[model samples]
Each structure stands twice: as structure tokens, then as C-alpha cells.
Target: MNPSDAYLAHMDAIVREKVRSIESARAPEQEHYLGQAELWQRVADHVERYRDELSFIVRDLHANPELAFEETRSAEVLATTLERQGFVVKRGAHSLPTALRAEWQSVDFDPRRHRTIAVLAEYDALPGIGHACGHNIIAAAGVGGFLGAAGIGSGKIVFLGTPAEEGHTGKEYMIRAGMLDDIDAAVMVHPFNYDLSAHTWIGRRTLKVVFKGIAAHASMQPYMGRNALDAANLVYQGIGLLRQQMPPSDRIHAVIDEGGHRASIIPERAEMSIYVRSLYVDTLMDLSTRIDDILTGAALMAGVEVERSWDTHPMSLPVRNNTTLADRWAQTQAARGREVLPFGVLPDSQAASTDFGNVSQLVPGIHPTIKVAPPGVALHTKEFADYAATDAAVTAAIDAAVGLGQVIVDTLCDDHLMNKARSEFENAGGPIRATDLR
Candidate 1:
């Protein structure tokens, strides 16, 4: 058989096998659905049927961008779409008004069983370029994956509408509200620098540091003024000095959000956007304390008062890919002659953060990334935004949706696999309260 023919044949066998397994299961197995093969068929069907709609969703979101925490329309659109798929939708799950959650049953196990799996989607766009990061594509892919699962899911599946992933970390709010209470595992896909999903994320924190001081006429009384800009400047300098002593894997990036109002006056207030990253959340906290010291010390030196606010999401532990789940889908993909590739680099590692990390901490989750654009096509750029609408991205979306659907199905139906996944999840310090937020 030709490659395409072989692939189709492989898919046919997988679906048939999965259906047979589901049909053959005993009474105790009623809690699970049939495995990956059948789910793949249904998911691929959903992706194809909704291709134009998903593409339209992605493009429109890309075309009209909004800033973090300001994704009102997009959140509604996502909630509406999932509602149409028959999910019990709840809007504003996280403290953020724009966040939404879609809940439904798949496995008919215990009514309150923590068999729930969550699929996260981000709809907020960047300030200027809009879906430049291809978040719209990410949202659509998530919808496609869950809807496919909904068709054949034996356990619960949640479609979480996360409002702002670019910076505000809306998941942080939802985490505090206990919205993810019933969820046991969470999964999502992201656009990455490469095709492989590395399954690990570096811990990160965002800080908005502000300085306040007395203002005076610049030319007439510059020296008499307690300049807040001076404090901000010194803080940056302090950061530079600290960087020399930081670990090689550590990262610090900053942008001046506010420096001064007018040249005629010594500025009374200034602010900076800052982020610190390391491989572990503990390291991030430790580094944060050190950075805080620097900022305060700088403000004191400049004779200014300082105020700070943080936008931090609940940490997502490093992605713990359910290898069994990956293997099942990988085999299904390989049956079609497609090799499931590992990340060449840290495909899973992001200098950024996701609430999805919180989900990984609880369940056997995977946030695999696929290659739709060229290797150089960085996310959240006009170039990457352009590619998200291309034919290649669409193809990748369909394939990934099918692949993920298959994994979910296999997870539900295979008792050994499901139990293993749950065990690993618990061992990883699983099922913490949705209200557990730092």
C-alpha cells in the first residue's frame, strides 16, 4: 500500500480494535470508553467538519486582537462554541470575568469521581498584533480535541476557556476559585519553535514594580526633586548586577512600562514590567525574593516609596507526559508511517507560564506542540500569525486533534493505562484544591 493507504489502513484497524475492546469490556469496565483508534476517527471527522469554522475562528481572533484580561468577546465565542457541542458551560470559573468552563460526563463512574480531564484553551490576544501567538489556533485545536472526546468519552471532559495566557495569567484567578476542583488531568497544545513537545516548562513570575517620589520643576529644581525615575533606573541597574550571579539557566527580561511624563518635571512615578524564570517553581520564588530586595533597595537609595502588584498564575509543574498514552497515539500515528518525534530542544519549555502547568501537576497531561510554520517562525509575530491561517497549520491541527482524541479514548478504555496514569498523577502530588493558590 502507498503511504496514505497504509495510514488509512492503520487507522481502520485501530478504530476497529478500540470499538471491539469497548464492546467486550466487563461490567466493571463501564466507567471507561473505547480506546484511541475509534476516538481518532471521530476526532478527525470533527476537525474536518469544523475546519472552516475553526479557521475562521483563528483568523478573526488574529485579525482583531485585544490585551490580556480584556478578552470579553473571544471568551463568549469559545463558550458558545463548546455549548453547541453539548457541554454544561459555566462562564467566569476563574475570578476573571472572561473565563469560562464547560463540564460534561464521559465515564459513568461515581457521580463525583475525579475522572475528569480538562483541556485548556487561551483566547486573549496580544495588545497590538492580536492572535500573533496563534492562540486562536490553540483555542480551536483545544475545542476540536474536546469535542471529539465528547463524542466517545467514557469519563468527564472539561473545556476550559482561559482568558489571558499572554501575561495576565487568567488561570491563576480560576485556580484560586476552585474551578478546576473536579479535574484530575489537564491537556493542551501550544505553538512552539519546533515540532516536538518537550513536556517541561521553566517556572516564571511577572512583576510590575512602581516607584513614587516628589516631583519638581526639571530645569528650576531638578536636584530638589525626589525622582521616581531615578529609582526605576537604579532598580534596572540592580537587576543587571544580580544577573551576573544568577544561574546559567536563569532568565530575567524587563521592559519599562513607565519612566517619566515630561522633560520639564522630575517624574513622581515610574514603573517596570519584569519577569524571572528558572526550571523549578521553588527557584522562581527564591529568585523573586532576591529581586524584590534589589527593587526595594534601589527605591530606598533614590529616596522613593515603592508599590508592586503581581500577575502570577498557579504554577504548572513540568509536563509529565503519560508515556503510555503517548505511545498509544504514537503507535496509531506510526501505523500511518508518521513517526512521533521528541522535541529536538525544549519544545515544552517556555520562558512563559500556563495554568496548564497546574493541570499537569494533578494529572497525566501532555502539552505537545506541532510544527505548522517554519522553524524560524516565532509565535506571537505577524509572520507566525500569517502561518496559523495557512493550509499547513490546518492539516497539523486536524492531525493533532485526531491524535489527542485517540489518546483520551485509549486512556479511558485501557484499565491498566488509566490506573497507571492516575497513580502517577497522585504520586506527583496530585489533586490539590482549586483554591490552592500562592
Candidate 2:
């Protein structure tokens, strides 16, 4: 047998065994807080009634995909849908043209005393594979959750349409613009291969290194030339060597953005773009320092000057999952006939980064993953994008909406749960700015 075929056969057996392990694994049990059962029923009823409209929204977004910071049509459709549902809509919110804010409050609602919760929506698509990340599901489900919970007669429900989640940290921009100043808690759901109430999302920062050197004729004065490409090559090798000493959770990847124009002429400048990720803020910072030192050393060895910049876009901090909120989410999902797994059940190697992580560090939040595809379907692929528009995804969206709406109701009605969530947030070092760590 061919080597590639043998490797594939071996991996297939390993994966099958892992799948069996996950299937037999049991999630820890937790007591559910006694929230308003009647109100939750009302929320479910509203979701059931609005099922067709929600499906239309999800399909529409999937058909007309938009990229980050350029989701004008997506935002317009979402805003119009919310407006038709009796929400007070605000377009161009948080200094972003594509961002939106829609709110619904009861007649006697008092923002001063009553808790306020925000349901977030992401509609940005990937560059080539549109909706491969299933953000359309997020948008539709969030809108459904807000509308479903609108019938409650206490607290506030705000549906925020956040764009640019694929590459740019749109939530960070919104946070800096005071979009979340008065919000008590945040909730959002992402489409994935499994039902998970709490999963790990690591922190990520971007680095750009530009090497400046002198150009000279290759045949005439090659010795006088300092090749910037040499520096890039050296740094690339240094990062590979540094990987063995780094933690298993820490990741660094780079690409040569600009190497040279022609082979005959010595390159005057070269640029590299790199991404650094870690499981915690402190570890991320430490990794950043080590990467900087490596880049500087590469420039010194190449006898070239180097300029390094961090975070061309906003950095994404690791998500701090509020157990109190996540448990409520798991309970609600259970009622939907889904067994939502807690953290550590799934391999941490399956983790990815998200802008929602930035929001979680600022407020008590839960970013759970709802099942939209089969167990082995990977994200950011055309197969996943196709599944994102199927009936299975629609069903998951409705179930997720109902679950998120119930969680909001619980947060607003059950003071004990909210207090416990707040305590957990504080204990996790409460509202640390992502910029401060850098």
C-alpha cells in the first residue's frame, strides 16, 4: 500500500475510536435554577410561530454573502427584519457603518434597576468560501432570540448586529465605542459539528515585520547589497526552532507577504505577516515577547533594519466561559432534546479563535456551539458552507434561538443565577482590557 494511503487508514481508525469515546462520555450534572416557566413557554411559542421568517433570514444571508466591514446589505436586511418585528432599530451603530443595534423593552422597563442582556449576531463571510463559518446562522438565531424574548415584561433585550468577525475584531471596536457599557450580560451561538455549552477559544494577536535593506546589482555589487529576504528566511527558521520550546497550546504561523519582485535584482524590502495565539492572556504576552526577540535577532544576523508592528486589527482575548450562564444554556438545550457537552469533553485541539472572546472578557457571556453538520465536518470549508443552508442548519438555528432566549429570560428573572454569574466574572479577573495586556 502507498504511504499516504496507510497514513489515512491509520488516522481513520484513531478517529473512529475517538468518536466512540465521545459518544460514551457523560457530561457533569448541575442543578437548574427555577426561572419563570410561563415566560419561557411564551418565548418558545414566539420562536415556533416565527420559524418560517427565521429560516428565510438564514437562507437569505447564505445566498448573499458579504465580507467583513462590508456587510451593508446583510445589515440592512437584518435591521429591516427587526424593525418589522416592532424593535427600535439603530443603523450605523458604534462608529461602524455595517453595525446595528435594535432594542425591545416592556412598558414598565427601567434600565437603572432591571438587568439588560444583549444577543449578538455575526454576518460576515470568509474570503473565498462564503458563510463557511456559519455566521448566517448566528445572525438569524440571534434575531430570533431577541424577538422570542421580547414578550417578557421585565429587563431589556438588545440585538446587536456585529460584522467583521472573520478577520477584524468588530466587537472590540464596539466595546471601545461604548456599545456594551450598560449591558449586563452577552449571549451568542456559533454553528459547529457538535452541541457544546462551553468550549475553548484562545487569544490571538497579529504581527507584521518589515525588513529594510540595500539593493544592488547581483552581478556588479552583490556584496554591497543586504538582502531583506535573507532576514525573512532567518526569522522563519527561527520561529520553527522556537516552537519546540513553546507550550503545546501556543501557536505561531507566518507567511511571506512581500519577498521580491525579480530574481536578478537584490530585494530592497521584505515583509512578513504572522499570527500568535495562546490559551491565556499572560501566556500570549509572553509568547509575543519571544517572537519579537526572534525577529530582532533575524534582522541583526542579516545586517538589515527591521520594523515590527503588532495587531493591525484588534486582538482577540481568550473567552472566559461563565459557568452559571453556560449551565443555564445547557439546561435549555437539554429541553430541546440535545445533549450539550461541557468543557474538556471535546479535545482542546479542536479550538479556534473568535471575536466573541474579547466580549467575554468584558462581561459575563456564553458563546456556545450548536450542531449544524455531521460529527467530522470541519469549519471554514465548502462542505460546511453547503450544510449551513440545509434544513438541518435551519432546525439547529431555531432550537438555538429558543435556547438562547430562555437563557436571557433566566438571567433577567432569576437574581440568584445572575449574581452567581457576576461573581464568577469577578473571580476571573473581571473586565481586563485586551489592549492593556499588549
- Tens-place lDDT digits, model 1, residues 79-168: 778776667778777677888887666446564543667778787777667666778777777777777667565677777888777665
The estimated TM-scores of all candidates read 0.77, 0.92
| Candidate 2: residue 356 Cα off by (Å) | 0.6
lDDT for each residue of candidate 2 in 1-438, tens digit (9 for 90 to 100): 341232243345435544543443344545445546677788899999889888988899999999999999999988988888777789989988999999877777898879999999999999889999999999989999998888686888888999899879999998898888989999999999999888878889998899999998878899999999999999999999988877665689999999989888788899999999877776677788889999899999999999998999999998888877887887788879997876567876887899999899999999999999998999999999999999999999999999989999888888898999999899768898887775
Query: What's the distance in Å from true for residue 309, model 1?
Result: 2.9
What number of clashing residue pairs does each candidate have, in the order they appear? 11, 0
**Model 1, global lDDT:** 0.66
The model with the greatest lDDT is: 2
Task: Count steric clashes of candidate 1.
Answer: 11
